[model samples]
Target: MASFKKYRVDGGKFSLASIDPADSPFLEGDEQAQRDRLEQLAGELDDLQNLLHAEGRRKVLLVLQGMDTSGKDGTIRWVFSRTSPLGVRVTAFKAPNDDERARDYLWRCHANVPRSGEIMVWNRSHYEDVLVPWVEGWIDKAELRRRYAQIQDFERLLAETGTVVVKCMLHISKKVQRERLQARIDEPAKRWKFQRSDLDVRKKWAAYQHAYEQALAATSSRHAPWHVIPADSKRHRNLMIAQLLVKTLRGMELAVPPADPSLDGLVVV
Candidate 1:
């Protein structure tokens, strides 16, 4: 097994170009084998999630960020396929609505955080505030820096309060994204997933990549570290993320509550 540390971003030293989206360091065998491994990992995840709910004492927040076609939704679907919905909640962040815009950027995110003993996945997250605004030239460097600090602080607060934050940046190449976007246009059923605005974002792909690189580097910390997952192969991406979550949850040492001595002599009717 490859150590996830290899993919983790060091403080203020991340380079998006350093990792290849097509790289599958954690993968083994052909496509079928990868899929089988993913299924196995998914089963482990389900068990771990049950233990998480049983323990009823810690929160988990998974933040997913990526370029268009980076498979953030697919990651959640396959990785958590066996876990009960009661244990996992997903929140996909779209553009800020008028109500959202009125508050500080992290306000909406704060409201959706996981409660004790639950896992919350953010499909797109507060990082978007830093990415879109800077890439579109809405905010300058100083403002971007401030937002980064705010995010770090917010995540630290979550950590101090018993939330374990695990962030992943789904890494994919421009060529792969183009192929995915084109496939969405070609496939009738997938056409709804394709948006005209996605093309607009594609035009600024380089800018978005730079923005992500900056945000990732600036915000990755001991409490809320970011992992870069190579995502060109959907199977490999699912396998990697599943393994990551399984490993992280296992480390939490989750277990069912201790039996009460007073109930030892009692029998159910």
Candidate 2:
């Protein structure tokens, strides 16, 4: 575990390109050692989740936003591998449906928030309101600014209500993304994950990167900050997010509820 001080973004001047996608600051071991550390962190997270459930006071929300092939699914698969589904839940947001489009953008997301004693991971989030629309020219500068302010306020509301939001922008290199996309096309086992529309979006890489930088700069707050994880290395990506999550949960100092004195001597037959 290392200090992630440099990676936290809080409405500051940020350049997505400034951070290398290949760098692994949080990683410090061989393949075997990395595996051991990740497993340890996963086990610790499961325990923390249990304590969170027992305490039953607050909740955690993990927001994963990334370009295609940034390993968002893989991160969730491995980071929470040791946890029970009873305590953890995941919601993956896709293109909005007609009902979702009829309401405010955050409506769908607000409905999926975590309950007390639970950790919720959002594969994509309200951020898409700003990102996709802005990238496609559907929203103007004025609209984008408004959306950002709305998002900040929305997150603040969640924080006021006892939600700890952890936002991670999984950063990956264009070269690596190309390789991953090609793998999906070439590898039969992964073909199901491939989307032809992905190539269409890939053409707007520069625009999307710019949009992300602006959105992150405008929306990242003290209550819900964003961390840019260099995801060129899949192992490091999983390790960093898992470690970040475990660390966040530990900071809550979760513990079981006080024992009831009346039942102190009770035992099952």
Candidate 3:
């Protein structure tokens, strides 16, 4: 398997345009085989998650950011299919409510951090504070830079507190997004997921892309690095994220806690 370093942004040096969303370097053989591999990865993720919950010491936070139709929900659905929900929490951030807007942008994010021995996934994260405001001309360049710094500091705090932060930007082509959006509009069963406001966002696609590039370049760091997953293929996206997560947890060297010597000879009544 190819190293995900090719997709990682480190030291603020990255070019989103250079990476093709259609590329699937990690895939082999036919589509069915790819599906099989993804299933295997999902099961591995389940086991790793179980171990994480058992160890009960550290936290894992997975942040997912992307364009409107970039498959954030789909990725979570497939990647965590086998993992128990008791140990995995999903937080989806939409347009901030009036109460949330009353406080600092990071307030809601801070409140959602994972607890020890659990995995928390943020569907849209604090990155939105940078992306939407910039694309809509709400925040000036200086404020944008300041927010980037604040984000880095916040992530550093998470790292210092024993949270393993893994961020991913789901990369998909505009044409693919259009097809998905259109499918949502055409299918009655999926129409509820479609929003008229999505069209407005599509009009500013280039602006949003530029905002994402800037945000990713500015915030990706060694402590909480960002990986851009090729998301034109849903299967490929799931496989890459699952593999990345499994690799991360494996690197943590998690194991069952040492058994109590005094209990070695004890038997249950």
Every candidate's CA RMSD: 1.1, 1.1, 1.0
Q: Candidate 3, residues 12-127: lDDT per residue as tens digits? A: 55789989999888888899998898889889888988888889999999999999889999999999998999999999999999999999999999999999999999999999
Residue-by-residue lDDT tens digits, candidate 2, 1-269: 58787778856688788889998987887889999999999999999999999999999999999999999999999999999999999999999999999999999999999999999999999998899999999989999999999999999999999999999999999999999999999999999999999999999999999999998889889999999999999998999999899889999999999998999889999
What TM-score does each of the candidates earn?
0.97, 0.97, 0.97
lDDT, residue 67, model 3? 94
The weakest ten consecutive residues by lDDT in model 3 span 5-14
Clash count, candidate 3 = 0
Model 3, CA-based lDDT:
0.94
**Which regions of candidate 1 deviate over 4 angstroms?**
none
Task: Give the whole-model CA lDDT for all candidates, comma-separated.
Answer: 0.92, 0.94, 0.94
Error of 1 at 79 (Å): 0.4
